[model samples]
Target: MSSVKKVLEIQRETIPYLYEFKDSKLTPFSSSIEEYKGQKQAYVVYSFNKPETEQGSGSRLLYTRIYPNESAVRTTGDFNTELGEKKENFTLNEIKWSVYEINGTPNIHLKGEKDGIVYEIVTQEVSLREVKELLATFISN
Candidate 1:
């Protein structure tokens, strides 16, 4: 049996958020956890893997929303290089974004599988503040 490297990273600031279960096998090219408008958000990636194309996740299709405060959610039957491509309207106040989008950066990745399979529990939003507040709760518990 093989053990996967899972590390939970906490971004410190006025509002903090945590990134849990990050893969260790992959090497990051540019990675950092910082604060955005009083919200702690992370911009992380590996030279070997990224949020979109790290493992076996295949395909990113584009779509648009027809509502205010609404965005497109990327759906994956399983997680790998990507959770999927999820675009949000930001106006919805219901559109989720990060755990995917780190900082002001966008992720582009190749798709596949690793050690059977891996999945990410994603919660996204337009505001880093909202993302921070949300994940802060995800970890404190």
Candidate 2:
């Protein structure tokens, strides 16, 4: 089964809401639902530059993760607490979001929660504005 179909199946069975890229330029190539410490997480990976690989590469990839519940999402309120107020926070339609840099790394993490489920979008190449646009797209969904 294709990644998109897998995501749809997972969404239909468990998640109430999920985010996806609607742009023609982004192509979803991989997806899966994982469990760790009894928590469920659904994720889809979209690639912008190429397709199909023996080993996946993170460059130019857009990754989105969906957690089944608030407690399942560890970074839910990290910006206000663990992050020590050094992150960028924003909101849209009652959904609160935060973008924080991974110390000593070039990657940025953007996370948010809605209706008890948490959603996250992470990439190494996309700009903050582009990330926000992606977040807005997710919110609209």
Candidate 3:
């Protein structure tokens, strides 16, 4: 099993949020976690193994929301159809999330709702420099 690293932990309102990072065995990529303005909102972007394809490579942008003393609902789906011609090289499967395009950039949107309280998280593209900076800040904090 791959070792997991706890990068950051913070509380938003009553719910506590945690961020973890791990390396992908199938690719040279790593996933990063980020939080939004509201408490209980965060997202994780990672490259996952796609056993259905010969290359065994795929990407997953997951958004999650945590509720206070309640269970959260999660929705996920594939966006390859919406990706149009860009869907050639990759086989999008087991998609249980949604994607939205804003200002020409595609973002994965994940939401959790329970007892009338909702938490929203968005997934963004990860970069090596950004990850280094984030880890440095996390370590310093």
Candidate 4:
């Protein structure tokens, strides 16, 4: 029973597109509900580490964010040139996602709206293939 699970349970009905990793190797680091201009948003961070023998043996972080309603979602660009290059754009299961390569490192940023709730996901040192695999596990409930 972690804070992430608790938040997910409480927000299960509120967030139509909420997702969590099913892999045991990935564990939630922290989760919380915060307010932005009177609107509440929830976010969870998960951390994973590969074995030292593996090529990418180090700590990696993945982030998930839920905007409970249309107003809470950021409508404008973040103006983050630091995100590096935008590789491509595609839609998956109604979620429009943008793939970006940050400093030649593997990463992803996915944001979309479903059932009026806006959902976003960001990954650090995580490959696009891996992110898609995780998304495939999500049950729309």
lDDT against the true structure, per candidate, is 0.28, 0.64, 0.33, 0.65
Residue-level lDDT of model 2, residues 1-141, one tens digit each, is 865776667755765466566676566767777666766777777776554563555467667777755444444332222222336888965667888775655556777777777777666576677666655555434
- lDDT (0-100) at residue 101 of candidate 3? 38
Deviation in Å, model 2, residue 101 alpha carbon:
0.6
Q: How many residue pairs clash in each candidate?
A: 27, 0, 5, 0
Better of 1 and 4 by TM-score: 4
**Per-residue accuracy of model 3 over 3-114 as CA lDDT, tens digit each:** 2123223222224433223334223232233334443533333343434564422543333333432434333443222331221121111112223333345553333333
Q: List the residue pairs that clash in candidate 3.
A: 76-96, 76-97, 77-95, 77-96, 77-97
**Per-candidate TM-score against the hidden true structure:** 0.26, 0.68, 0.26, 0.67
**Over 4 Å off, model 3:** 1-46, 50-60, 63-99, 117-141
- Order the numbered candidates by lDDT, best leading: 4, 2, 3, 1
Candidate 2 lDDT trough over 10 residues, lowest sum? 76-85
Alpha-carbon RMSD of each model: 15.0, 5.0, 13.3, 4.8
What RMSD does model 2 have?
5.0
> What residue runs in model 1 are displaced by over 4 Å at the alpha carbon?
1-16, 49-141
Cα deviation at 49, candidate 1, in Å, is 6.9
